[model samples]
Target: MGKPTGFIEYLREAPTEREPGDRIRDWNEFHNPMPEERLRTQAARCMDCGIPFCHTGMLVSGMASGCPINNLIPEWNDLVYRGLWREALDRLHKTNNFPEFTGRVCPAPCEGSCVLGINNPPVTIKNIEYSIIEKGWEEGWITPKPPAHRTGKKVAIVGSGPAGLAAADQLNRAGHWVTVFERADRPGGLLMYGIPNMKLDKEKIVRRRLDLLEAEGIEFICNTEIGKDLPAEALLKDYDAVLLCTGATKPRDLPIEGRNLNGIHFAMEFLTGNTRAVLDKQPGKDYISAAGKDVVIIGGGDTGTDCVGTSIRHGCKSLVQLEIMPKPPQERAANNPWPEWPKVYKMDYGQEEAAAMFGADPRTYLTTTTKFEGDENGNVKAIHITQVEWTKNDNGQFIPQPIPGTEKVLPAQLVLLAMGFLGPEQPLLDSLGIERDSRSNIKAAHGQFTTSIPGVFAAGDCRRGQSLIVWAINEGRGAARECDRYLMGSTDLP
Candidate 1:
């Protein structure tokens, strides 16, 4: 606490965003940097609570109440307020391996539990975090520092997503050799392809980290799928230990009528193609385009939001997002008390853009897509939707039953299915002979990274099923520690 009265003196302020009209014209990030002095003032809003729940990373009533990686929020907020930027960056790096990525896209659970948020607006934690990390990069404070000693124990991490990267970083720092294998041409799994370029600039953030990891003596083998391109037995034989971080990549499909129409696509296909085109500077003529097309996005979650943003960038003619869940309450109910208010309504970046353009939130809650209708050319032309209500069935399970007369037909030139993922595809897991849990996630107990096969372990989304980037990093780090301990009698990594 640099200033005892800082919280009172400063009101919450965040980075300004590009105007909707102006930003939608380009795929660049929409956020405008807050002035340094104003950012310092924003940082001053940290309350220095007796118990800073913002960094605790616990789930209160099944909702995340803080940073999942246990980020040291107050300490860095104080440092930033005092203009000790390098120190703030140091404090941030202690807990989080990639603040730039989290700062840009992560929904700030820490702010929801902030003590200041109970009465006043929460501190601008996300903005301060983004500023600190960007500053760290600009000042050349971040660089590769490979471990001085080599333990000669080799560890192979499958999947170059957040969890795999985190584990590799930790294991490498502990002096063990680390190699990350990625199926995609690029190293970052979802972060590289699944997430669009506007929210997270691939080169500036994702590839930048990959470069640093490479310089730190972590080897990345891109386009080398474990099961297909490279045999699982080779990994088992070449490396002392294997850590599976393969993420849940299989998209959940809407298996209703006309599902295979030409213009209908999984959300990832549209997103990944858009990103690859941007990076490669060679968007093909046949590429999926939303420009001037009436678009309907199914499933309203982070992925759906991303679809909205990307479609906006593509100059979509009209956009609508459908959700099966009921609309969340505008304000936290009595049942959702302090440190449990994140579920309350808040417009994300995409929704904000949509509202600015469409004059309303694009979401149609308590609605589900019944079927798709295709035209003579085998292109999707419309979707049949129905409103549904949740009711407890005879078995005491909440089931969605469609309303009798709420069906509607909406014209759509392009339909994006963003219904989330089922689990990791089983082909690779099957090839490795790795066991899986009931959820089809790689069968490994939490904090115990070892797979049924000796010298093989699993972590990240593949092990835990689809999850957040912060959780991926946490799992990666944990798996790295356990792998190190398994390889070398002990590990110094935290």
Candidate 2:
């Protein structure tokens, strides 16, 4: 422990976000970094528990409550407390390939499972992690360290998202040749296109990481789809082993009345186009504009939140986010305990901004859209909604029961479906002849990334379904270790 009484002496402090009014005017990041001295005090608050459940990366109560990458949290905390910042950065990089991405996007389940959180607020692990990496970049400590020698073995990674990148990094470090293929014009799979630049600045962060990966002897082939542009047989014939890190891109849809209306679009279509416009340096005349339009987003999750934040930036006239489930409790219930991710309600960044602007939270719980109402010209005009309550069917499955008198109509010029992804698209998996699980995910057992076919493996959202980036990194490293073993009969990778 850095100080025996550190926890008692210091309280948590997080970096303040930019003012709502000012941040809404642009689609840039809004958070300001905390001063170095204040961050040191925050680091001092780490209790450094003997058990250290924060890094366990296990599933607790059906949710991940710890760091999935098994980060050296305590070591870095102590180093930060003693002002050994460069040392802190080194320790963090040992496990996490990119702390900056996780620091900003991850929900910080480690804090919920913290030992100190049983009584007091948890240590500011996420903020400390963010600062460590940012400082490393600013000081030029983060640079490509390509392997000193090559083993002459070749590995092909199908997707260039977080998992594929991490796998390529580790495999290359083990002295193997690694090449990443991306269907998009740029390398990052979803990181480059699916995600908005505001959350993760594409040019600054994503492309920067891609550049370092390239310099580390990892070759990248962009704008090449395996099943389409490049045949799947080509990859199997050329590489010693193939790692499929394609993310879950198939989105679930709501098939209801007026589904084919002009203004109703898939969330990815809207989000991806907006990002492309930004990258192109202009939204232009063809862009989907929410300006002066009432927008209704269906499915309340991270995608929904992104839609909320993006719509605000476009100067939407009004917005409403609908969730099929009931609102979470304000605090943990009797059955709920500490050291697990709390199911209690807390506003996400998008909702926070929405609340600040609208004087109320934009999310509406226990609601379902029955149909889209369109104008004479076939553009979406309004929405028909019905309130629902969870009720047990005879089979004991809780189902949404619509209330008869609760049907109402609301104005909506544009509607974005933010329902979560179903699984990896079937065409690529089918072409490669890989088996799938009951849930339609690539059938790779946990911790055993090997697929049905020999010398082939799967990782990330495609294998595990939609998940956080931290888990993707873990799977990537694990898959690389397995692939290395397959190639050389013995391997050293973590």
Candidate 3:
């Protein structure tokens, strides 16, 4: 440890963010970077715990308890504390292929499992990680490092999200020629479109890495979909092996009476169009605007939060976020102990922005929408909602039960359904004749990513369902190792 008693001496400090009121006017990232000296001081707070559960990378109570990618927290914290910036970057890159992505968006399960967090604040692992990577870039420490030799094997990776990109990087490092296929106009399936720009700067962060990967000899073919633009059979015939990192993107729809009404859309439809409009420097015809409209966002997840932020930027007249689940406790409950992800309430960037603009949190918990009410023009005008209580059903399964006389109508000119995805789209899997699990995810084992068919593998959301970005990277790296082994009858990837 860089400083033995630093944890006892220093209090946890994190970087300040842009004022929500000021930041809502633009589509820029809100987090302000912490100074090197302060970051070092924060890094020094890593206690000398014998078992660093912070990087244990295990699941407790079906949720991630620690860093899923198993980042070397203590080593990098020590390196940062000693001012070994480049060394810290090296240690970071050894485990995480894209720390920049995870550092920004990943819910830091590692901090939850920190040994010090039982009684004291956890170390600022995510901030330190972001600082190290950004520093690496600023100092030009990160550059193209093409493999020394070619293994003469060609591997095709489908989808260019976190999982696909990680696998491509690992496989490319192992001396195999790798090509990534993306269906969207650009690469970065989720990061490019699904996430709003205010959270992650697309061109500055995501594109920079994509360009570097291309410079390192990995090929990215965009605007092409496997099993559609290009035949699935053609991919199998052309490449030595194929790995599917196609994410879970099939959105769960609310098939209510007015679902087909105008001004109502899936969360991705709204988000993707907004991002595309931002990147293009103009809103396209497909862009859904919330300007001067009363916006109602259903589903109280990250997606809904993003919708709130985006709507605020669009100068929405009013905003409301409805969550079916009850509000979480302000502190960790009895069931959620140390190492388990805390089921506590904390305002995310969107809610913070909403509160700054609207003077209160936009979320309304313990509520569910009954139906969408449409106007004469077939445009949604309001939502019929009711409060609900969770009670045991006939099978002892807890379910939401609507309370009598709780129905109310809320005006809404724009409605965005941010409910999560169910699973990956089925067409590609069906076209390739791939096996699917009971949950409709691709039937691929976790550690061994091999699919039912030979010479093919699956990883990330398509296999595990919707999950955090860190888990995608972990699965991608693991899949790459197994794929390399399948190709050469041995493995070196880690």
**Candidate 2 Cα lDDT to native:** 0.89
Would you estimate the TM-scores of all the predictions? 0.97, 0.98, 0.99
* Tens digit per residue, CA lDDT, model 1, 1-494: 87778888877777788888788787787777888899888887787788998988887886678888999999999999899999999999988889999998888888888998887889888889999999999999999999999989998988888898889989999998888899888899888988888889898788898899899999988988888888989999998999889888888998998999888989999998888888888795436889999999998889999999999988899999999998888877778888984567778888988999989999999998889999999989999999999999999999999998999999999999999998899998888778889988888888788889987888888887777888888898889888988998887787
State residue 1's C-alpha deviation in candidate 1, in Å: 1.1
What's the C-alpha lDDT at position 199 in model 1? 88
For candidate 3, report its TM-score: 0.99
Which sequence of candidate numbers ranks them by TM-score, best first? 3, 2, 1
Model 3 superposed RMSD (Cα): 0.7
- Model 1 deviation from native, Cα RMSD in Å: 1.4
Better candidate by TM-score, 1 or 3? 3
Question: Cα RMSDs of all predictions?
Answer: 1.4, 1.3, 0.7
Position 424, candidate 1: lDDT: 91
Over the stretch 232-271, how does candidate 3's per-residue lDDT look in tens digits?
9999999999999999999999998898899999999999
Q: Between candidates 2 and 3, name the one with more favorable TM-score.
A: 3
Residue 95 CA displacement from its true place in model 3, Å? 0.5
Whole-model lDDT, candidate 1? Answer: 0.88
Lowest-scoring 10 consecutive residues by lDDT in candidate 3?
252-261
Q: Residue by residue across 1-494, what tens digits does model 2's lDDT show?
A: 78768899988777899887788888788768999999889888888679988888888888897899999898999999899999999899999988988988888888888889888888999999999999999999989899999999999999998899999989999999999999977788778777777788888888888899889899999889999999998999999999999999899998999999999988888888788888888884446878889999998988899888889988899999999998999877777787788788988778888888888889999999998998899999999999999999999999999999999999999999999999999988899888999989999987889999999999999999999889999999999999999999998897
